[model samples]
Target: MILKTYRWSFVVTAVGLVLAAWYGLSAHLGIGQAIALVLILSILEISLSFDNAVVNATILERMSDFWRKIFLSVGIIVAVFGMRLIFPIVLVCVTAGLSPAEVIRLALAGGDPETPGTYGYELHEAHPTIAAFGGMFLLMLFLNFIFGEKEHHWIGPLERLLEKVGKLEYVQVIVAGAVLLIVAESFATEHGRTVLASGLAGIVTYLLVNGLGELFNVEEHLEHGEHHEEGAPARSNGPTPVARATGKAAFFLFLYLEVLDASFSFDGVIGAFAITSDPVIIAIGLGVGAMYIRSMTVHLVEEGTLAQYPYLENGALWAIGALAAILLISIEIEIPEVVTGLIGLAFIVASLISSIRYNRAHPEEAHAETAAAHS
Candidate 1:
């Protein structure tokens, strides 16, 4: 079953490694050096993006098979080529006042800071705005998740406190905005206005995507109506919106995932340049890593991993919150990639351990769940 789920990832890995090796030889960087760089970048991307896969699985479970396929297929193309490659070029072009052709030419020139037209340098220079936008968007995601109603709490005291605060409407927005203001004030000596505007845009983008999705979702619509079928016995107020939404609701969800992906990719895309300036190599390596992540998401959904390990989603969100903080803090102080990766991994690992203990202590619940699955 695992093999069937991840066959595509395996194929992409083989092809990407071959491409990495061949390009290293062609670029005269030596095959060994080329493979090493690609491998390092890929590992870094995967390490930094495990939380992304968890969050993605949660959303993907709410979508139908068709949208899920679209996400894995069309979405992957947009993620690998669009978000990682093309969008960076577009951003550089807009920032540098150059055309797409000129941007691509510079990218091919590689990553020298002294060079007039180094692609990596231009992209690296644009990091602050990228950080502000992506950071704010991801921060909102984490805020909304923790603030909204949840039956389980991963970090009892802190989560409970946040939940109490969440009872006030739009508290997530207020907190996120406050964080943005603080970040902007500290980085005021830098691109203050640009960062503020970019951060605001991120918040608005989230509101539109999330708001529109919820508005169109059948679950929400039914919940609002308080209607019941005439011939039916009494039922719960409404069904939970999971893996059953369709039509316009799913479309907004699709858009949300793409934006969410772009937010997650900001760090990886920038960090990849520190390893190698060759955009082609970065594309192949990160692209392959992305394939594996998509596969991992599907595996989690099909195996019902999130349902089994209930706190995992909360852990992933907390990791996202930490990353958001790091991204915002990075504007004033340079942060290491290792710090971000370690923080996220720690949350996920702790959550996994907690889940295991929870299951063991409640053997009856676990056995009942297992029996229901078999039935």
Candidate 2:
């Protein structure tokens, strides 16, 4: 059963290992060193992104099978190449006025000991802008979840209070905007305008992508309308409009997922510099990690983990909120990546324990929900 469920994961892992070995050998590093570094990088990426997997599974489970397939296949390509490799090069090219080829050369060259014009140096210089944009985007994601009403509450009093405040018009947006302004003003003195602009861009991006998804959500609209009529079931109406809208909705959802992955990648890319300034190594390591995360997401959906563990989503969202706050604060402070990873893992484990206890206490309720899902 395990092999059947994670067959793709196993395949990807095998491919990643072979690639990691080749890259390491080509870089002229010893085989042992290369393999060890790759292993470390992969482990770090997985630990840091475990919460990301949970959050992704929550979203992926809602998508149609076609979209899920795209996420597992095309999505991995985008995540590995776009975020892990090309993103830094683009940032350096745009910010440093270097050509793409030059950026790639500099990245492969690692960092210069004598001067500060290497790819790693320039990318580090752009950290403020990266942090502002990614921080604000993640903050909005966190705010929306916390502010929205949920039936199951992990942190009852706090979540309940936020839910009440959520009834206020655009509370999440207001809170996100206020926080952005405060962070920009207080900590972004050197690049105040740039930080503010980047943060605003993040907010705008989130609104546009999320709004498009909602607009294409024909199923949600049908379900809302069904509440007003007698004996109207909340399912797809038919084959035509449902199919068309599902395609559009899936496109928007794909966009949203990509943007979310980008936000998550910002920190990992920056932190990879701490491990090694070699862009190739960083890419190989993070790429391997990204594949695992994607596989984990699919596994979660296939196994109905979210449906079984109701509070897991809540835990993941809470972790996102914590991560967002940390990202904003990291502009002024030097928070260790391990701390970030630990906090997220802690929330996930706590939620899992809560879910297990709930299952034991209410076996009948658990069985009923499982049956409903299967039916």
Candidate 3:
């Protein structure tokens, strides 16, 4: 079962390690050294992105089979080439006011991040804006999940308060805006305008992508007349079959996933520089890690793990909220990547423990959940 689920991830890990070895030998680094560095970074990426897999599975399970195939194909391409390699180069071009060709040339020159007027240097200089955009977007997503309608609560007291606040008009938006305003004025005083603008862009991107996805989903659902009975009145409160979306609605959901991936990539892309300035090695290591995350997402969906552990998604969202705060705070604090990953992992572990206890206490409910998932 594990092999069937993670075949591609294993293949990519092997290929990535081989390429890393080749690159290391060519650079005069021993094969062993090269493979070791790649292995270390790959582990780092997996640890950092494990929470991402859980969050991704929440959406991936709702997509149709064809769309899942598209996710494996097109999604991998974007995750590897787009965010891992090309995005950093493009970011340098924009931040350094250089042409794409110039940026590529700089990168080819072995742009050590410590050196000014180089690819890595330019990219690092753009970190503030990157953090602001990614942080706000993730914050919005976390807020939406916790605040939106839900029968389950991972942390009853806190989640209940958020849910009640969610019933108020645009509370998430208001809170997000307030956060942006405060951060822009206080911590990012020098680049306040840029920080605010980037944060606003993040918020707008979330609103546009999530709103459109939900809108198209409603349209697709109504068009199918999914719950309407023959010669019978339509029911307004029928079960929502959001998990069966396809066509344009599914396309939008796929787009949302890509954006979320991009936001999560910021830390990984930048943090890799702390180890090595070689973009190729970073791409190979992180790309392999991305495959593992994708595979984990598929495994979770196929195993019906979320159905069994109802609090898992809530935990992932809480972790996301923590990450968003860490990203924003790191604009001035320089928090370590490992620290970020550990914080998220702590939340996930707590939630898993909570879920197991819930299941033990409510055996009947757990059995009902298992039956529904299988059905």
| Top model number, lDDT | 3
Please list the residue runs of candidate 1 whose C-alpha ends up more than 4 Å from where it truly belongs after superposition: 113-117, 219-243, 369-375
**lDDT digits (tens) for residues 242-330 of candidate 2:** 33234777789789889998998888888888888878778878888888898888788777777788788888888888888888888
List TM-scores for all candidates, in order: 0.92, 0.91, 0.94
The total of clashing pairs for model 3 equals 0
Candidate 1 residue lDDT tens string, 1-375: 989888988888888889888988888878988888877877888899999999988887778889988988999899889987788899999878889998998887786644556888788777878999999999999998777667568899998888778779889899999988988887645878878998999999999998888778756447556444665432111124333567888889889989998998888888887778889888888888888888888888777777778678889989999999888878777788888999999999999999888889988876775554334
Every candidate's CA RMSD: 3.8, 4.0, 3.3
Clashes of 1: 1
Best by TM-score: 3
How would you encode candidate 3's per-residue C-alpha lDDT over 237-312 as one tens digit per residue?
A: 1123444679988899899999999988889988988887778888888898888888898888877787888888
How well does candidate 2 score on lDDT at residue 339?
92
Q: Which lDDT value does model 3 have at 251?
A: 95
Runs in model 3 lying further than 4 Å from the true structure: 227-243
Q: Count clashing residue pairs per candidate.
A: 1, 0, 0
Candidate scoring better on TM-score of 1 and 2: 1
